[model samples]
Target: MEIIQIVGLGLLTTVLVLIIKEQKPMFAFLLTAFTGITIFLFLIGKISSVIQVLEDLALKANINMIFLKTILKIIGIAYIAEFGAQIVRDAGQESIASKIELSGKILIMVMAIPIVSVIIETVVKLLPA
Candidate 1:
């Protein structure tokens, strides 16, 4: 049922966007954005549930909250970056899309430094000293 709904919505939007693109490019772009937001809205509940499960699992595993949270944030950035890049690419701005992806990667790497340092320090402590 979910697949059916998603496919139906996707097909409907595709037809609508294609038909409207020639007459109103701006409107087509707005329609595409609206459709994307709508789909994201539909998935928000699922996203939250997944986040909660991850948080609980991390807690149970005795993982540091800061590191876990940072990792999740990095993952979120990657996903959002990919989404934005795809949208830009769809609008025929491949160069800008690539830039956006690069920025996301840089941000993720910066955010991961603390976790990486912790890992490195732990490994060093475990070595014969």
Candidate 2:
């Protein structure tokens, strides 16, 4: 489907969310969550194509696959964490959402440590006697 169609679907979902929220709050939340996930799945193909192009460029530039993979993982973590946090906030749990964001940041840093260490090691070895 075209992006305009997706946008129309999103608008319809928003109106439904508001209508259902008053009578059946649980169902409203479930519908909103499902719509968000459905939209994400729909857009995955576009994201994958973009990532493929980036991978080709990185390969042409002789970038390390391990580093590139780690960066992608970090980006994935950030996106998922933000998505979850926004849902939590919508459900009226701001404090919990903040904690989720904090944990995401920590996890990203942990994943990046290996790449940092590799750079440090390379720098150390390059010193001349």
Candidate 3:
């Protein structure tokens, strides 16, 4: 039922955007952005529940809360960046979209440095002195 609703909304938006694109491209772009936001908002509750479960599991596993929060922030940045890039592309700004994606990649990589360093240090510790 959820998939059906999402698909139906997608189809309807496609039709509306197609029809309005030529006459009022700005409006069509706005519609696309609104649709994206609406979909994300619809999923927010589910996302929150999933995040809560992950946090609980991490706590049970004795993982550091800071690391979990950092990972979550990185994921959020990725999703938001991709969403923004896609919206920009849809509005015929491929160059800007690519830049957005590149920025996202850089940010994600930067955030991952701590985890990567920890892994490297762990491996080094395991090596024979």
Candidate 4:
């Protein structure tokens, strides 16, 4: 049902954009950006519920909160970067979109360093000296 609503909205926006694009490109772009943001906003509640479930599972498994929080932040960065890149791409700025994606990748890598190092150290400890 939600998907149907989303699809309907998307279809409506597409038609409107096509009609308005010739006369007002700027408005068309703004409408597109607004629709994208609206969809993202609609999903925020679902995202929060999923994150809550993840937190509960992590607690039950006795996982490190720091690691969990870091992983979540990385996921957030990925989603935000992709969203931003798509918006920029819609604005016809492919180069900027690529840079945004690259920045997201670098940030994810940086955020993961501590977890990666811990895994490596654990493996080394388990091996014969």
RMSD of each: 1.3, 2.1, 0.9, 0.6
List TM-scores for all candidates, in order: 0.92, 0.87, 0.96, 0.98
lDDT by residue (65-103, candidate 1, tens digit) is 888789889999998999899888778899999999999
- Superposed on all Cα atoms, model 3 deviates from the true structure by an RMSD in Å of 0.9
Return the clash pairs for model 4, or none.
none
Better-scoring candidate (TM-score), 3 or 4: 4
Residue-level lDDT tens digits of model 4 in 25-126: 999999999999999999999999999999999999999999999999999999999999999999999999999999999999999999999999999999
Whichever of 1 and 2 has more lDDT, that candidate is 2
> Model 3 Cα displacement at 35 (Å)?
0.5
Q: After superposition, how far is residue 76 of candidate 2 from its true place, in Å?
A: 0.4
Which wins on lDDT, candidate 1 or candidate 4? 4
Q: Report the alpha-carbon TM-score of model 3 versus the true structure.
A: 0.96
lDDT of 2 at 14: 95
lDDT (0 to 1) per candidate:
0.89, 0.92, 0.94, 0.98
Which structure is stronger by lDDT: 2 or 4?
4
* lDDT tens digits, residue span 1-129, model 3: 777887888899999999999999999999989998988898899899999999999999999998899899899999999999999999899999999999999999999999889999999999999
- Choose the strongest candidate by lDDT: 4
Where does model 1 exceed 4 Å of error?
A: none
Model 4 CA lDDT for position 88: 97
Task: Pick the TM-score winner.
Answer: 4
List ranges where model 4 is wrong by over 4 Å. Answer: none
Q: What's model 1's TM-score?
A: 0.92
